[model samples]
Target: MVRAGLMRIARLRVTLAYGAMLLVVTSALATLDPLARERIVEKASTNLHNLAHGHFGTLLGSAFVVDAGAIAVWLPNLLCLLALAELLWGSTRLVVAFMVGHVGATLLVAAGLIAAVKEGWTSTDITRATDVGVSYGAMAVLGAMTAALPRRWQALWIGWWIGVGAAVVATGGDFTDAGHGLALVLGALVATRFGAPEPWTRWRLGMLAVASWFGFAMVVSTTAALVPATSCGLLCALVGGLASRLSALRTRPTPSATDMVPDFERHALS
Candidate 1:
């Protein structure tokens, strides 16, 4: 009975199954003719056609394509990071973090691209660019793992990720890097509800602020036709003003006992 119980527990690891499937599919794709593999990846992509057109069905399909060039590197990391996340957070939470990171980053990127197109900063043809890979999901899982670690370790891991992401964004504001940074933020945000300490850490609240700003920008930009520019500008101003007020509330110093008059002394004076 003891042996059977241990075996059952071992079998419950979702990461192994997911990793095996990833490897198998990646291997199969590698064996296919180059053109065939390319066609498959293209069809699975969540580019302008799938995202802007609301064909979200392709989102899951696109995650299966591991990007042939990145398979050796991404596959190992996925297995390790996902396995560790699953070990800490269980299967369901890991899946949620991964999906939130992958889907949220993809949508955010698509929205930004659409906004850029409307603003005429990027060529309209850029929308058709292929966007398929597993890094977003991997990075998301990796990000969530920070909340599962000890506080000291968490700081180091999260800081390293943020620093790298910022460096990447600073150097190259490409779609992939944008998606990566967004994925990390989404991962950290989503995982807070699951494993993070109570009272919410500074990083957790910071993620919320970032998310709120990003969401506001995305909604306004996407609905530029429906919302007047004046109204949108006012909305942005309101959100920024509110955020500043909240920050002030959080940062304002509280009075100490010595800084306040005793109620008894005031009553006696009156």
Candidate 2:
């Protein structure tokens, strides 16, 4: 019981920290140099435009366009979602899983963006109407939570994401369906692994870590130069999906007690 309380407190702290970081970043972006802010907005706008045109490459490229700028704006929302998950799954393992899943989705989007650019499938006149920060991450969070939810409730959440995506498209807004899709896939994969927590097999985890790092590196390396943004995002999504599947495969016989006991305790204790 004491251990559980400590875990809860820790999760709250982490969530708060994430929130603070987000607030700071938001303020900085709003008040920083005009040129920097303009660049950020431009990149964000370009991202949205690419998303609308099915230029997934550019959307992912947009993530890396502002260095830590995008992440600063994005990670807090993702962390908040994970905080909710922590309430159910406990702080340590669930947080790690959430982080991994979120990072995996980001990388996947980047890969897809790069791949699209390489293929010359994207248009040159990319505009900036589609840059909404962190919506994809939020969607991914909801998707991951839904995937981990009981089978009966899963469909509703899945439908919700689909509906949201459709609405974005219908309204002619800049929505990165590709990023949302990739994030969902990553979340599902992470949820599956977490749902059935297996033994900590070094080889499987190592492989996933390596793949994720490689995808991240690719995004970083290509950010400055002229590379195919859409193509890279696609690649990230592919690699992330494959890695998640591999991790899921290794984590057989899901960990029921870990997920259930915490919730049960909270309810019972309260």
TM-scores, all candidates, are 0.68, 0.49
Residue-level lDDT tens digits of model 1 in 1-83: 99998874674477777777888888999899989988888777889866667768778877777774656655554565665
Q: Could you tell me which 10 consecutive residues in candidate 1 have the lowest summed lDDT?
A: 217-226
Candidate 2, 62-107: lDDT as tens digits? 4333334455444543454546655555556454554554455555
Best by TM-score: 1
Alpha-carbon lDDT, every model: 0.67, 0.50
